[model samples]
Target: MDIQQQLINAGQYLKANQLAWGTSGNLSARLDDHHALITASGTYMANLKEDDFVTFNLQTGTYEGTRKASKETPFHTGIYRVRQDAKAILHSSPFYTTLFACSSETIISELFIETMYYLEDIAYVDYYHPGTQELGDAIAEKANEANIIMMKNHGVVVFDDSISEALMRIETLEMACRMILKAKECGIKLNLIPQEVVTSFLEDSKYKPRKKKGENFQR
Candidate 1:
């Protein structure tokens, strides 16, 4: 509804958490069924405003707004195309997610319950040059399994209906990554929670939306 305000809030949160610096991160919120408002390319996260966001058509998938959408938009668009439930997407290069992102394997959390609840498992899509079809395809494949994904050697990407929830997911992911890094300092094996526990936790809390697909925006 209020896309600009949403951008402002997300930008502020990014600044407060140090998740982004200069013009490094981007965020987007669905404007209607067929359109989303995304941060324009090259906009600094520390001082972002509503006007800094641009509109992109969902079906045709083009930004018609005065300002250009983020260059990494294909990454965001790929997720949106695959996840009908996702209303907001956030892309950031936080220190730890970036650290784990560069790993050969996909990062999974055995450390935090929040990680289990927010993201059953984090997916890792191997490096593909940004804004490319290959990257989008790899990312979309992962989107089917999880909402939070670590782009190989890139950063982290998150999707959820509410921008607030998506932002929280990013925070949780960073915290878990930080803990893993800290524990590694002691040479102790990280005790990750079992898959059974994560499954049970998800069963305990489930959301059945009244409307799975909102009205698709049209030209």
Candidate 2:
């Protein structure tokens, strides 16, 4: 599918799954090294159209289209610039994910293999006013450390070489957060998988074919 359609579908999917509430989130994809396609400011993710997106130059912050880019556009562009392997980014304030973000809890448990692999070493960014250059700079500093970035008291920024991979990790992160909460409620103390086991999984050859290209590239 085309990049536009992929974004549209992603918005719809995120909305339907309750990952994006109100107009509190943004999504973007790199058009090239210098430009990106991002959702417009205040556009509802569930009701997106082609015109709801703006193509903006990363270097100059100039937008070609009539619509204004999302206020969080700087962070999106900043991430793409720093992380060349990042082809798409999904920034949303999901209930469970944001819940974990607000707390001191970390999403480092390896309750599932998918969580261990997809969300390896989730990074944290301290709270900064939304849409500010400070937040953008914070993201840039942490972009190279992990694929999923948890903005303290805000939301999360997830990126990957493809929209599919990015979305997969987004869903997985949310689900993992929910599971963590549920386990706590049930009085089940969660134990992270052993470090040795995690190391082995990381070095496992079975997942080589399924892994996306540029999955390990850092800024």
Tens digits of per-residue lDDT for model 2 on 56-95?
A: 9989978887788999987897788777889999999999
lDDT values, one for every candidate? 0.77, 0.87
Cα-based lDDT at residue 75, candidate 1: 75
Best by TM-score: 2
Instruction: Tell me how candidate 2 scores on lDDT.
Output: 0.87
Model 2 lDDT, residue 123, Cα = 85
Off by over 4 Å in 2: 208-219
Q: What TM-score would every model get versus the actual structure?
A: 0.86, 0.93
Report the alpha-carbon TM-score of model 1 versus the true structure: 0.86
